[model samples]
Target chain A: MGPAVKLKDLYFKYSIHTDRSFILQNINIELNRGEYVVIAGRNGSGKSTLLKIIDLIYPPERGDIYIFGNLINEKNIYEARKRIGLVFQNPDTQLITGTVVDELAFGLENAGLSPNKIKSIIEETVEITGIKSLIDRRTDELSGGEKQLVALASVLAMKPDILLLDEPFSMINVIYKERILKIIENFVRGGKTVVLVSHNLETALNEALNNSLMADRCIIMQSGRVEFDGTPASLFERKAEYIESLGLRAPIAVRISSEINKNIDRNFPICSDIKSLVKQLTGLKGKELKK
Target chain B: MKELIKIKDLSYSYNSQNDSRSIYFRNKEKSSVLNNSFALKGINMHIDRGEIVGIIGPSGAGKSTLLQHLNGLIMPQQGSIYIDGKSVIDEWDQKELKKFVGLLFQNPEDQIFEKFVGDEIAFAPLNFGFSIDDVRKSFKDFLEYFGYEYSFKDRLTYKLSGGEKRIVAFMSIIIYDPRVLVLDEPTASLDSENREKLIKLLEDWVSSDRAVVLVSHDMDEILRLCNRVYILNGGRVVSEGPTENLLFDEALLEDNGLDVPEIVRLYLMLKTSGFEKIKKFKTETDFINWIRELKNHA
Candidate 1:
């Protein structure tokens, strides 16, 4: 019921530049605790920069950020980061250990949890991510999807209240992508906050919309500015314009469904999984047709 | 439609076990770490002179392993590979074939090593025995196409962004003017804008009569570029056919752990909604146009 994180007039540019080539500028938003929030933007729109700032990895040049009602300062940066778990875009950058089991357990150790407690948490997270089968396997030996699951398990094992993941599903195949999505959903349901930076627009946005149903929040960024901040339905109002700012188009499902709904009183809903969207729309068909 | 690259009943595995060197020295008959596993299992594939084929499957499907076989990176254990009417295994001459087939692996860090940006771009042409003058000219042209200012030539490679690193990797591959291009996970880490550029690049390559084989998990990208799709599952080419057939083939796609495109599903949904004629439109533009026409008819 409280704000998990807050960003006020945040501006972050490359450290080398005093110029205006920032990834984000004049950013303002609030993320609630126990929310699964997805921040969508085109590449170079500064979504990752924004996440790094929130996770306390990158301090903003100017602006204010508060974590759990506490203003973040230089002294408490490490403590803030420990409360927020960030699974980097490249698993290689994030996975420092040599093996999956160790990788999954490292974050807990870093969080300074007791060793026995870390073990129990790692066991639970590994089981939830279904990486128990892959725990002993070499991180390099595991497939892309398996490595991605290990990455998620590592972060989840830390049990941070606010989890920040950048392109978490990029390396994964669709099967493992679905599995991680479920685990993330359960974490949010259990009152953890999540902010995900993703290149795959459809899945992250749809999942945030479906279970949360715009109940959390969606922040669409353009040129380092908060272009739109509202529920999914509100963002859908200026779908074309919002997509252009996001450096993408309205998703195929939204496009097709809206197109079909143009001729009828359509719900024009958006969903990530095309198969499930098909089944839902097919259910609305009057009767079985004679093929 | 001549055969460009061919693999016949090939198999391979990694000598990954720690005891392989020590144990093998002590006992020469010790089995390798990849003893039981096969990276590639009797793969038999044929690419025409200019065909864009999409290889799709879940993780650990041997997609990356198969791409490595085109060049001499990893020789096949039990099978033979032929490129441009010559058997690569028996003939043992990929000097020109290496130039013909340019491979871009997943990690940019794995393939890129030069310090300066221009040197990194020129690394390939230099390897192919191009004269300094000739390599310099080719590097200049690719840098121009890649939209790098002249100032970027001396910049450090690691300082470049992820998208920039990938562009340099592509430029390295393209400077040689390879006849066939193989890319693994080209669009995965890129943003939408860069992803669009790479898509356009592939679509153009497909039109240029240069065969391009892609092993990617992005179904939307596969639908857009590839006319033919090869679905690999469990170290085998499980399904290969036209892109239209592959996209509509839900059972095969699902079996291989792939997601069907959203447009196709919406198209099918409109079937019993009294619009059953044009339910197979592939792209966003095509589907939107279908709905535009469906409005008039309805």
Candidate 2:
């Protein structure tokens, strides 16, 4: 019915006793329903802190947060939290139960869903995430990547209106990473909201190009403030000097494209993948045409 | 080149404990464990002084298990390891082992414990019987090399950022000056600028009397830093060769779930698209130079 998340004049600091510097200062942002947003920054630049605040895990010292246009406060905090699901960078932190099935069922059980409904949701989540083989395996016995798949399934079983993933697949292997990205693709295509935080250049590029899951907005944070906010294309096209100064990086294809453009003094469009980049470089429409 | 470390017929597996009373022990699901067999299977590798070697593989391929064997953190179930001409299986003194090989695990939080940064870095060397004056001199040299100010010595280890913590972890290890340095995903948390700085620092380190064994998923780093590489899959060495040659094998790399570097991909795509003039270049600078030459010809 309204923007999925809205934060106004949010200000936060760890505590009054610690250094008085604000950890987050005068933040204002709004995400419409079905929008995909990426928050990128160097470590300790407050990317995780922003996600925590949005999930209401860390309360802002000042300002208002509205989820789906309803202001969040103690009176409605529990109800609001039910509508948001969070998956952390480390799957071990979020996985509670011993087996995958129980882990997926834990959240639904807490929400007081009927047993049958829980079972069906778990099945659907396993099918979507393609973690059917891992459904019965013990969480501790699973590898880092497998644990992340279980974590994603556990969160998706709730069917929350807003999904927040904090560096969700950085430690995962490529095979599981692609499957996880596929799940995210399906979720976003179904007109849901996602806010992903990461510094991984490869995943960002692949998700941007192959899936056409371009971020509606990209926000780069620095020293507890938004240094840059724009489209993903603009973020990748920023000068190397500036991006490096912010302690971030562009994908390798983008980097090569930039160098080629600089050498030729002609703006060859930035291609997120190598195939398209080669196409642009040779000025060929298709592979057959070149042959 | 004489081998500093030799791993022969190494194999390891996690045995399900008979005591299942622990909270983490799920006795019923023991058979369902994804990898019930050897985490590492009859692995063999060698590291020589002044060599930079990279070990890469997909997750669950026993990359970390292989690293743990080099420093005797975990003993080989079936084979032997030799460090500095001494068999690690027969000689299990970690204190003596630390003098020859310094291992930095993937997670810095697991390795760093002292409250202050200076205390954290100084703990190991002091324990190893370094005189106070020697420790002070080494710390000063590290400060100058890493470009850290004197005031940074007082900062708490836990309070530092992720990248800063990794750098400090590296400093803690390098202060000891082990002949062989084993680093697991050293650049995972570092920003690109810091990563570049680390590459240069590693290059300098490996050019001298020290050898470094790096384990990572970053193909670019492997291609840039490592002279030799071993590709592991399912706890076995799938391929091992010079970095340039092994990385160029697209089928081997992709089948192992490793991403081919984008520049290499561009070369292949151009060749596939019938651009006969495209040539393979090893590094970014060479690639850029070739591009400039192409522009000039055009």
Candidate 3:
């Protein structure tokens, strides 16, 4: 069994005001090893704050977060942070280097990787991301998605043990949106832990949600608390209204499949994939329940 | 209904490398968005007075490009647009054209110039030489309608949040009360509650016989507010119809660069999967009611 992430009633807040202000409260989630997870909710639901906490960009006010069986505290916080890579919501904020080539090598330099290996990693990253032509372009000129790819290329060069993304595709064009999803999916398949925070319920379900359906878990935050935390299937299997009531959109597939079950007036699992939903429908009609 | 605006085979193309390179549309080298291409082509669309029309398509579908033409922002290379039967693009003066149709760009930050919030909101009308008294009456009413306190007038415009910036952006046009308003991505970054309010404000504006054109990537918002939707792809109006068609046509939306509303997909799945064969819903509630009927009949 591989080491997994554990949260012990973790309390996270952005400000010092205890009684009035708290970004996240009473969050207890366990992300399994090498799992691809999505934490989704409305804006200000603490999705971004949680990822920032996991990424060690900010400290949790109360409770402990364990990554790979190691409790994150002051002692190991510096060492533990090396394992996490966060592709932030705003690309402009994360960018430190003036040029693309420097950005690709920035994290590796931070990790004290040798110069020879650094050159090889940068080449592989720029080539794989298809940003070789764009390496020389100024940061201000790149479009929304291109900037994100540059940001991602930099992170991948570091080769962190776990990855965290905060609305990584929010500003990009649709073409790059699909491309980043594929890139992130492939990155997860390589056996590195990945957790994402996004308000884009549709993409989360269609792209990463299914890949992490059974093995991985997601936490739905509401009013600064964990509303639902479980496998994707488990979350959709029973509760539909609880999510909808919170002004959060369920995965399109889940809602549609559920609607199918309702229209046909029969119960079935919410399947994100079209093929599986069709199969489920086929099986249901095979029985030919009296119409 | 008054014919607020009209376009007759409107066409426009920009030099990609040379944003300032071309004087005429025909001189542009590219026929399409192949590196440096056409932003719009043969766009023949119109909005009646008081019509709340929606423009939607995928990311690069030229929705914004078409909206820019409505207000005379980018002069067309080869086309004619008539506002109130007047050839606004071909003939009207710049100041007069701006008063009839105010075009609101997506990023409010791009539009902001004045330091104070009040100054920014009042800038457009002031530039049009509106009397100070009229601007005062209109600005106060507009701000109150959107649920903002009067004191916000004193604050710095740039310091406001994304949602607040959008409100200020809309107010800039509304203070002058343009008969035809065009807004791009009106609620792109707003939270759910604020988004609802913004929609309501837009709806009221449209209902006043002051035609409003909304260009949005969020199909759900358009489905709720717009009476008619024009689906633009590759610089042409490939599909234009009532909200029912745009919202229900999942294939048209997805292929054209939009994710279909969940209700539409559900209706589609049910239809294809041997449940029923209905293709439209005016709203989610309407769809829900229809589903319940489907179950009852089953």
Candidate 4:
């Protein structure tokens, strides 16, 4: 019922000097549990910094962050981190061991779980992630997408309540990207909170629609501040202004929809997925259905 | 068009024993799978001059490896490479290869080591025996062409943002004016504005005397810029054709670990759903025009 993660007046700067000094100022957001929230922003807009702060990697200069209704402090930071799984853009950064099986076992081992328990968890994770074939492969041999999956599996092996993925789909192939999205869908259906920072909003939009699980909120960040936050559709409607003002590209669907809406007096539905967009076009008032 | 980079039956394998440094240092191999953990099996593609050739495949599909071979970063163990009709293996030396092929690595941090942007861009040109005056003039021209301020040359390389660093890294390679350019995900970190600028720069710079080989996961960029696309799956060429027809085939794309662009997807979906009239649209603008026509008829 409460927010899974809450940020209040978060302000961060690497240093005090003013010239090109990095700053994340006056940030306030409340992400409810079991909700999928996408954080879209241009590079260096503090998207990754925000995720790092949530993971307790960076201590905010001035702010209060609550995780699972518990205020995060130095005392509770480690405990809070245990409840969250953070995957970065490059999976290799987080991977520790040589083999996939060993990599998955490392986290559980760190948590001091029994060897038998770790084995069972690894088995279940491989099944859930559908990476059974990769169990014996070397971490260095895995492709970028496979590497991301292994990273996800290693993180999920800990059974964290919250998932924070920063551009997990950036280097992944399309098919593997779909598989990763399906895994994320399953995670959401299981009532876990997810905050994904990605540039590929179109893929995310399609995945959300296909699963019948639209993003509860979309937050666009500009200059380390929250520019817009609302449903995906609302975000699409104002995409032009965001593109111009925030320096973020609107999804292809949003771009086309906006172009049509601007030139036509009649309202055309903003369809995020290709199927729906086609339906809207072919099912127009003046169009004749073949069937 | 002249064939700039040609490969036939190319296969490369990274064996544990083949790692010379590790073998010399440790006196033994590290991993047990000594044969070939990562291998490109029988890859063949010809990159023509003045055109952008795209390589797309699933992760670990050896796309990056394929790009490396074009520039001789990775020597082919099984096949041959021809650069402008000359055998890459026999005719090319380290300096000749370095002078003839410019590779913009996947990660800027790996390639850009100089403290200042000016020195970073000037390194390759100077290394190849370019006079100091020529190098300076070329670097300045490159910065101006990319819309980067002359002052950017003085900025710290690491201080620049990810996109800026990538651009600088790319410019560093281009200053040498290699006959062939290979880019690994050039637009991965760029914002929309910079991406458009870089696309325009590529269009202006790539000509019949020069060619480009681009390896990227972004299908849209591949569709927009590349004249021809080669889809590699498991280190083998699964498909190759003109960009439009290759990207238009939804099933082929999906099978090769790729996806059609959203507009193309919409067209295919409508065509399959009994909207035969959708055949007229190939791009989003075409579809928009069709929508305008429908609005007028209404």
lDDT of predicted model 1: 0.71
Report fnat for all candidates as fractions from 0 to 1. Answer: 0.38, 0.36, 0.09, 0.49
Q: How far in Å is the alpha carbon of B11 misplaced in model 3?
A: 6.0
Tens digits of lDDT, candidate 1, B1-298: 4777777887766535433232102343433333435656777788886788888888877888788888877777777888877877767566776887899887677788999888888878888888989887877775665555777788678766565677778888978878889888887767666677778877776644578988777787888888788888878888889999988877778888887665555666566555566557778777556545544444
Better of 1 and 4 by DockQ: 4
Tell me how many clashing residue pairs each candidate has: 2, 0, 2, 1
- Tell me the deviation in Å of residue B129 in model 3: 8.6
Candidates ranked by TM-score: 2, 4, 1, 3
Model 3, A117-211: lDDT tens digits are 88788888877776765555445444444667788788877778788887665544445556666666676678777887766555566555434
Docking class of 3: incorrect
Task: Show pairs that collide, candidate 4.
Answer: B50-B207
lDDT of 4 by residue, B1-298 (tens): 3788889999887663323222111343344345345569988889888889999888878887788887777888988999888887888886788789899877677799999999998999999989999998988887887667899888888766566778899999988889888999888777666677888888788987998889888777887789999989877899999988898888898888786666676667777776666563445667778777766767
lDDT tens readout by residue for model 2, A39-151: 87776688878988888898898999999889998999999998888987657778888677788888988989988787788778888887765666667656556777788
The RMSD (Cα, Å) of candidate 4 is: 4.3
- Local lDDT at B295 for model 1: 42
Candidate order (lDDT): 4, 2, 1, 3
Between 3 and 4, whose TM-score is larger?
4
Model 2 spans with C-alpha error above 4 angstroms: A96-102, A113-120, A133-141, A201-203, A263-272, A284-291, B17-30, B132-150
Off by over 4 Å in 4: A16-20, A239-241, A264-269, A283-291, B16-38, B116-118, B131-164, B280-282, B293-298
